[model samples]
Target: MSDRHMICPPKHVAIIMDGNGRWAKARGLPRSMGHRKGVEAVRETVRAAGDLGISYLTLYAFSSENWSRPEAEVNDLMGLLKAFIRRDLAELHRENVRIRIIGDRTNLRGDIMPLLLEAEETTRNNTGITLLIAFNYGARDEMVRAMRRLAAEVAAGTMSPDDITPARVSASLDTSGIPDPDLILRTSGEERLSNFLLWQAAYSELMFLPELWPDFTRETLIHAIERFQRRERRFGGVTAPSLAVGS
Candidate 1:
């Protein structure tokens, strides 16, 4: 039998790429150096995901809380982000991957926001793997923003407050059109969601790895997929096959 027969693949795989700064510190290099190298890992993982037939890949690129870092480090990260978007847009388009940015972007630098919008516009219609970059994102903030918007409509009498539900909140989120993640992977051995995707990860299978984001290779990603395959995601039920029979 083939790997496909034994492994259950996730249609949407979300990753929290952590430990760039720590990785760099361990190497006696600047944190920005780690981020720059992490971009290479991003490229490799994207290719691997496409080859593995994974449809959606959401990466936690930057969080709103990250802004609290030193000004120089924050600027450097933003610079790296801008460079990645500009350098990788054409290649990503060539791979037929649709690029999307999900976050509270109102406070982003004007220059970077325009480039991000341009990148999204250029690859909006591609039909391959969807690469969602969560920049300046915080799950709590996302929910609050959605609630505020809905509350405004309800107060205006344009929408009924009683009609609001999880579906409505989901639709109001930045990731409205995308499906919830089936599996969530966090590297660098961290074992927390860290406000990545609150509502969207209600039933996601999670895997934590010790490898830092800069050191993540295609092999590492493939191994994660392989591990994900071994899990029996019951999703609160007992429909999975019996392990004794499969073994």
Candidate 2:
């Protein structure tokens, strides 16, 4: 496929930015250093997606289970996040990219929460591309939290339990208005989902790369996009139209 054309261009792309700690350890560097470098990769990937005409890009920045790491490391990661947003948010806005943070806000520090909100509000009107950061997120947790809210509303008679459905639950999710991922990429050769977006990735094409998060580049993204374009998405039922002969 050429840079101007692809076989299966995904409108939404989600990525699991993994292997930062391992990448750092291999180089005898602090984990924070790996995270700092990972930010550069984020910038590269976002620019590549925008250039490829992708409408939505989601990054698994932090997971709910990540709290199990050392307190110092967690603090450092949070600091890196704050710095990334503060420094890059303006440039991203100028590029017409909308920023949105998804995950459990209750676990975030009050001070950090405000910064996240500000980032989202700052680029809410942009129409070019959306950058979704999955911080302190877990797909299972999101589903559970949505269900709990629905249950509470039903208990209070403000909503009916019978009215609860997939659409309602989806609307309650942090990514309510956004479409589910069409392509999912994981770096560091990891094959697991890691509870990133279990429900949203039902039909997404999965691609695993051996490169660490910080090592990803525009070329890597282009290769992945090209590979994705070659696949035929049947979405269950009959075969793809491309496979139909004599049509």
Which candidate has the top score in lDDT? 2
Cα-based lDDT for every prediction: 0.89, 0.89
Q: What is the C-alpha RMSD of each candidate to the true structure, in Å?
A: 3.9, 3.0
Which stretches in model 1 have alpha-carbon errors above 4 Å?
Answer: 1-8, 240-247
lDDT (Cα, tens digit) per residue for candidate 1, span 119-158: 8999999999999999999999999999999999999999
Write down the TM-score of every candidate: 0.91, 0.91
Candidate 2: clashing pairs of residues: 8-229
In candidate 1, where is summed lDDT lowest over 10 consecutive residues?
1-10
Deviation from truth (RMSD, Å), model 1? 3.9
Residue 233 of model 1 has an lDDT of 75
Tens digits of per-residue lDDT for model 2 on 1-247?
3343543468999999998889899999999899989988999899888888888999998899999999999899888888988998899999999999999998577478899899999999999889999988999999999889899999999999779988898899889999999899999998999998888888889999999999999889888988888887877856857767876
